[model samples]
Target chain A: MSVLEGINSKALKTGDLPPPSPSPNTFRIYSMRFCPAAQRALIYASVKKIPSEVININLQQKPDWYFTKNYKGQVPTLEHAEGKKLVIESAVIPEYLDDIFPETKILPSDPYEKVQQKLLLERLSDQLTPAFGRVFRAIKNPEELKEKFESILKAFEEAESLLEGAFYSGTSSPGFVDYLIYPSFQRVYWLTFLLEIFPLPSDNFPGPGYPKLSQWFKAITAIPEVAAASQSTENGVGSCKEYMKGLPYFDYGL
Target chain B: MSVLEGINSKALKTGDLPPPSPSPNTFRIYSMRFCPAAQRALIYASVKKIPSEVININLQQKPDWYFTKNYKGQVPTLEHAEGKKLVIESAVIPEYLDDIFPETKILPSDPYEKVQQKLLLERLSDQLTPAFGRVFRAIKNPEELKEKFESILKAFEEAESLLEGAFYSGTSSPGFVDYLIYPSFQRVYWLTFLLEIFPLPSDNFPGPGYPKLSQWFKAITAIPEVAAASQSTENGVGSCKEYMKGLPYFDYGL
Candidate 1:
């Protein structure tokens, strides 16, 4: 069978690929290098010790191969061992990785813990993503934009405080919640620092309002894996400003 | 123990509670009666044979208790046995149910099958909740409104087609995926049919575009557990239109 076929087939479990010796199947990741969603898949793959062939995609003009694999044309689609296939959306892919690799234990095992993890992750996706995406898009009047920044900072401050008592819920290392949420958090901070948009008149970041969060950001950047993930030239604040400029409908008042 | 204490303590175990005992210690569903999100919690409690106390929330007024339980103030907060507390987004609750009641086996046991199941459920949440939500809210829009409807219908049709040849792929009974997704589907159809928004010069309700989906809707609704969970209401589409009108800024281009 072909490599893609192996990926799309049932021959490979998510975490455990059949030994490369006999069939020597390879895993492939189709995504844009800097895309946060794509990075989620890559992060899991990296932690899982799985090597993947990364295909960086262009949003404006998608390649035919991408369309064949995923009609939706979104990034972070995966071709597994048997080539059975899965496509589109970042959050779902990481969950699939958790499913396949029970040994890795990226997701929590206890049902309630699992549920808590899932909900927290979803909040990151739903609340945090939408809020930041909206901010990045900068869709409101100046006063309105200022108000939103305050609101987002308030929410972020809460999350930062939540992280205070525990490295991860009192554990020594970052587990499911930390891994799932940190990429986006890092992205936000990088943008904020790069853009020099911190300490919004309404709400302050990198200040007393977000002391725990500010500290956590410092701690996260110290991690080698996180440092490696970022190649963004823009400082934390500059990235924030540049992110807004890159939005498709930046002028439309989201 | 008090209601709030039980949730935080994580004491609610599935079989630990003696087969649906009467109130206080029994299950209580804190939900908004009409919210699609709250429906997920209700449906699972119904399916798993867990008894719950129902708390009605008025989204407009913003209940104080709701804020206390969930800092975010969202409904579908579950207060269960043993002082176990869970408060987060709607999409995360079912996994909680499945975890406690392994016998019901709402999700698949095989690792690969689990991956497929998780992926499907997440996709359902994305397609049904936000993506379709945008379209449903735009019923009053002209060009943008039509575009939204087309996209929703397309998603519905695609999802319907994917479920061919099975009650569900991973399990014998309607497991997590079925129960999780059906509520949204149920609400969507009811809304469309009630509103007379169909045949809107853009698409047909159960037309060739969504024939398979129409069939699945009929089958899922017929299932006793799902059927019992639904409160037959005035047409959903009309109700949705009315709901939208009441909102401050829901004008569709004439």
Candidate 2:
């Protein structure tokens, strides 16, 4: 499959792969195309209009230096000012970006509301993301798939209850919570599409049960910055299919 | 077993169980005595001298209303201003407390340092805490315990390297990262003591493999606030014994 829109497809398999072309003073984000965690950072940077170079990494075949950069070897590792400082972990990176670009505030001004937004993201990452992963792993098992899907629905319902306004930020503008969740839901959209091709006993996707969550999703996706920053749904489905085949998944061919 | 000091021993099994005597306008934290996650919040509040009432819950027999408060029914759920606002998740709660009480800043002033602190906590929560849990669950299986312990050691090594100064915050006082990790380590300390009574091959705890981490741990524990907030080592071991016996753990006899 060819590289999709907004997706970086460079493949660097050897230790000798040269460091990304320097952006000098600008921040750089080490990312993988299809990684939801990495996408959160990327979307935040884009939404905040922060000038950052998104350096795509082939996680499966990372270079030796990548480990030195982030010992965990995970994506969304932000290299600040050409490696003067580096930060890892998806949750930390986005918040860091918000702090550096306070003018374009992704987090809320009110401390209480800000904490509430963070709590929602924390719940999603801790509960929903793992359940989403299980759905892919249990593709062949109807019982397991159904159970995982139900778990995802429960998370969505909780999220729906949390949403009070147009966005999770309670503003029209997409914020930290929106970026935190959108990528995972995007993957779910792709999973639903793929499930149609490869049917299961309980293959039905969890339709939007909560009106607020449904409206919030629509509002966030409608934003130009979010739309431009997201990877294609088609590519996500393809990667998931490869993952199910026990192949090297997440390899979006450059 | 009688409840230990600083531990709440009240048991409430249903919705009909009365809410604890109201603190009215003051802040309240719904917590369990031996919960490391809850301890993190309590220790943070203590370190900052945040005036909040700690409402101890018998988690094994939670009141029905507690679920309404925090759907997860987890401890360390902070009810801000007598439930005007609520925040759950150990990670989120401490950070929330830190934000509201910025006078005693647990998070760093510098953006880069702040992110690093968060990343360290993120790594500990994601990697070390689970390994620590497995060590408890795999107590009967020496090989699994050994494997889990080794994984934990790797995390410690990484953490040790992150410690350039006295504390993870690179300051004299324990901060966000310290509060985040100390409780888990306290649990580990008890686990090690219990393991001594119930020995296994490779039974030796990861005895401060890195000099910096050893020094860091010593420095943090030495702080007055930290010492005041921590549960007794004896209580932790007793709790772990009950945990291993497949009985309800965290019953720190007040």
Tens-digit lDDT track of model 1 for B109-190: 7666766776677766777677567766776765677667766666676686677554545444567677778877766666
TM-score of each predicted structure versus truth: 0.73, 0.86
Write the residue-wise lDDT of candidate 2 on B32-52 in tens digits: 778888888878877777766
What stretches of model 1 exceed 4 Å from their correct place?
Answer: A1-25, A124-128, A138-152, A166-169, A196-209, A232-254, B1-25, B124-152, B166-173, B200-211, B233-254
Q: Residue A27 error for model 2, in Å?
A: 2.0
DockQ versus reference, model 2 = 0.74
- For candidate 1, the TM-score is 0.73
True contacts kept of each: 0.50, 1.00
Best by DockQ, which number? 2
lDDT of 2 by residue, A45-150 (tens): 7777766666677777787788877888888788867577888888778777778778877788678988888877877767668867888788888777777787
Going through the candidates in order, state the TM-score of chain A alone for each one. 0.73, 0.86
Q: Give per-candidate clash totals.
A: 56, 6
The all-Cα superposition gives candidate 1 an RMSD in Å to the true structure of 9.6
